[model samples]
Target: MDIPRSFRKTLLAHLPYAVNEDFTAADDLAALGLNSMGLVQLLTDLEETFGLELPDELITEETFATAGSLWATVSELVPAGQFSDA
Candidate 1:
């Protein structure tokens, strides 16, 4: 399955240091400049974009470690049939 375009766009907006468009799912977001402050803001952006709230237990360093990991966690929270290629 592909990551939602909204998710990708929102994530990219917060990643100030991201150098290229080829960033992969396993890429480290922090290395791309997603610092602690960015992460906090990202959480809010994600919730508002997806219209869902991530549980407190799900908010952890591991969940935000990589793009793929974060997508996996988000994919689980959002309703099925919501992911699209657009």
Candidate 2:
């Protein structure tokens, strides 16, 4: 599966009203209504799904600002093509 797409799917699953909406890399999660609890859930899901641990320092407002930014952080820790199907 595509990492970002899977990420988006997981995010939408956690959100109450995001089922029909289209999400993009540039979309701001905060503006999309992701609160503290949602963020915590997202982090937990991301870690579990990707099998990677995020550093404390990387869990900043800016890091979760947008899908692209979050993907950048994930990519840094996960390495390229790790989640891409062969």
Q: Name the best candidate (by TM-score).
A: 1
Clashes of each: 0, 0
Which residue pairs overlap in candidate 1's backbone? none
Q: Which residues of candidate 2, in runs, are more than 4 Å off?
A: 1-3
Deviation (Å) of 79 in candidate 2? 4.1
Weakest ten-residue segment in model 1 by summed lDDT: 77-86
RMSD of each: 1.6, 2.9
Summarize candidate 2's per-residue lDDT along 1-86 as a digit string, tens digits.
13456666767766664554366678778777888999999999989987899999999999988767887888788766765642
Give all TM-scores, in the order shown.
0.89, 0.80
Q: Which pairs of residues have clashing backbones in candidate 2? A: none
What are the lDDT scores of the predictions, listed in order?
Answer: 0.84, 0.76
lDDT of 1 by residue, 1-86 (tens): 35667678888988888765556789888888899999999999999988879999999999999888999999888877766654
Q: What number of backbone clashes does candidate 1 have, counting pairs of residues 3 or more apart or in separate chains?
A: 0
